[model samples]
Target: MQHKVIIAGGGTGGHIFPAIAIANALKKIAPEIEILFVGARGKMEMEKVPQAGYKIEGLDIAAFNRSNMLKNLTLPFKIIKSLNQASSIIKRFQPNAVVGVGGYASFPMLWKAQRKGIPTLIQEQNSFAGKANKQLGRRANRICVAYDGMEKFFPSDKLILTGNPVRSSITQSAVTRQEALMHFGLQDGKKTVFAFGGSLGAKSISEALRNILPQFVEKDVQLIWQTGKLYHDTAKAAAVPYASHVKVFDFINLMDFAYKASDVVISRAGAMTIAEECLVKKPVIFVPYPYAAEDHQTFNAQALVSKKAGLLIKDSEVGKELGTTLFSLLQNKALIDQLEQNIEKLGNSNADMVIAKEVVKLMG
Candidate 1:
């Protein structure tokens, strides 16, 4: 019989893309392998996994809400219900091993697998391990991570610095500047500053950009900004006067193109975005989301800043200083080149394959 593996997690592209990367690596090594994806029923993974050509099952699960205490009142029931559902799915799939990428849904799935005596693997993308990953790491056969000194988070003996798994298309792509500008329908031969707030968008970043559209046009710098879903229209409306030099959207499906065209990038410091930036060697100014678990986004950005590989600006500071900071960086070619070299040094294109190899070996 071929090897069977179950990959768990995904509510965001951060988790889903990496999960899919590892699954693809495993298949590349052993083509006949059977893979099953376990995710939360109503999450994005259900749609994304099918699109990626994988079979998946969703458990009814919900995370403890920190914002509204009342929302967490029913969390206990959801946890129990999800755990029971996970057990049934595990029994039916009969995977030789389980791989977890952190999200609320992964907890029930990985926890049940460990109890059943199946070898489990964890790919923790953040600098600070999440509550789910930390709890599961205790018994996890292997813990794959992107950053160093994770010994404090997981057992030193189990740590494997496999880096974060990136999407296969992204890993193999080389989207050039001309091509990327064309994709955005913006002209070439101008400095491009790429700004995005992730898939949902960042209101502060959007507002900052909205207030400074004239500054970009005045400087002759072309802009490709992703305004998140909420702020997309506002950003577009603000950029309408400079529409020839500015392109605003809610989301970017062709990220490779965006990365290729930009000279400097302004973004929210999410774990996956940091990884992708390193891969593309773009100089970035990160505004860490203040609300992420344990303030991990700042840790992610700070680690790069410590290396002098990127810049950091707080989310609150975006409203006050985003334009000034970007203008300063835009004018300094030496600084941008230095940042490019330093950040590119940290890229790890094969992390997905490395983690997959380690997991398969653990299973055997």
Candidate 2:
């Protein structure tokens, strides 16, 4: 019989892209394998998963509010409703295995799958475990993680250190620097820096870059900036005067090209971003989001920083430190080459295939 799998979770590109990569890997191994995705309603996964050519079911789920106690009043109801919906979907789909990537809908979907005695896996993409993943770790059949020290959170036997899965386009990109620059209408003969703060944008990074825009021009450094949705308008207006010196966008769909064009990258320390950066083998400066669960982004960057593969700047210190640090790195070809080589050693190009093979073994 053909194996049918259910992959769940996704609010951010970090989760959505990896989930799709796993699905793609599974399909490659067994072209007839059926795969489905379950994500929170109104989340990015609903749109992104479909765009990746997979069918998805969305549950009316929401994460627990840490700041507003009143907002969590309806959380229990939402969870219960989501669990019931998940149960119905599983019963109808008759999946042989269920995989939960971290997101609000993951708990409900994994809970339902485990209760039905189906094989279930959970992929935790962060260096520090989230509360939901920690709880699900007990019941999940396998816990696939990106970092090595996850035994502190999950049972040792349950943990498997499969590095995070990055999109194939990025991992296998052949886009040359000249091609990438031409695509962005950027001129050659100058070093280019690419800055992005995940899909939502980073205000601190954006503001810091805005203030240092003239400095970049003075140094003849070109920039490709992804301001994300929140800072798009502000960043666009700021870039208008220096169109020749910078290319700013709310989102860049062609990240493979962007990575190719960049001599250095400044980004949030999200797992997916780190994975892509490693594969691309670029010199990087990471500004971790402070509010991430247990400040995991810092830990993610620290893993690379410890190995001299990347540099880290705290979110609060970006305004004071980012510009000088970036310019200094831009002038250091030796340090940049060292970072590239060290980071390239850390890349795991076969994570998707590794996870897919594990899923097949568990199914049997």
Candidate 3:
């Protein structure tokens, strides 16, 4: 009998990519197994999942508004409606198990699966447990976490410490520095700096880049700047004069090449990004997004900072500190080497496959 599994949740690439990783592992283990994704209606998963060649269902759901309290008045209704939609989807799919990677639509769907007496697993990617995942932990048959010290969040016995799964392109990587530089059209002799502000883009980071572009060009530094989709055009226009020293894009699907080409990386401290940085063993200056769940991005960066694995500069402090932070790291080869060595200690690029194997084991 073919086992049907549902992987749910996704607002950002962090959640969506992990779901894809598990799905790929599951298919490798059992080619005949069935898989489906249930994501928030308007989220990126709607596009990303299908592009990855998986069937997906979208629910009309949204997270309770944290920025504007009044907007949460509709949340109760949205939750009830989403629950009804989730139950219907599960009834039709009849999944053997459901795996949640953490996002808005995951709560109702996984809760319904638990009520039906079906097994459910959760992959929590953050150092800090999300409120929804914390609530789900009590009933979850398995909890796969990417960090240690998660005993405070979930039952220690139920927790499986699998590191986060990075994209396959990066995990099984052989992209040489020369090839990566050629792909970016950058000269081999020049130092390259990588920059990105998550998938949605960070306004402050983009602004800081504008003020610092001339400086980078003057220093003979090359850049692989991914200026999140929202600010791509603006960043491009501002960075026009320095095009000789820059490669700007909204996204880079070929991350293995990007990481290999760069000498230093300036980035946001999302779980997935941090995992990838560790896997690549690159020096980084992390600009943690202050509003991330529980300010978890700060915690993620702090973990690196404490270990001297990476430098941390908060989002709120970016305007004044970001440029200086990147400047120091780019110029200091010893500091860069120290960070690369320390961060590499935390890399577990195979966690996706490990997590999948464990989830399948529990299903039996």
TM-score of each: 0.98, 0.97, 0.96
Q: What is the C-alpha local distance difference test score of each model? A: 0.90, 0.93, 0.89
Whole-model lDDT for model 3 versus the true structure? 0.89
- Between the candidate structures 1 and 2, which one is better when assessed by TM-score? 1
lDDT of 3 at 344: 98
TM-score winner between 2 and 3, please give it. Answer: 2
- Residues 1-364, candidate 3: write the lDDT tens digits: 7788999899989999889999999999888889999999989999999999999999989987778999999988999999999999999999999999999989999999999998999999989998999999999999998787999999999999898988887888887899999998889989899888887778878788877899888889998999888889998898889999988999887988999999998899999999899999999888889888799998888878999999987777877887788877788889988999999999997898898887687678
Residue pairs with clashing backbones, model 1? 201-228
Q: What digit string (tens of lDDT, one per residue) describes model 2 on residues 1-364?
A: 9899999999899999999999999999999999999999999999999999999999999987778999999988898899999999999999999999898888888888888999999989988998888988898899998888899999999889899999999887888889999999999889999999999999999999999999878999999999989899999999888888899999999999999999999999999999999899999999999988789899999999999999999999999999999999999999999999999998899999989998998899
The best candidate by TM-score is 1
Candidate 2, lDDT over the whole model: 0.93
Give candidate 1 regions above 4 Å deviation.
none
Q: lDDT for model 1, please.
A: 0.90
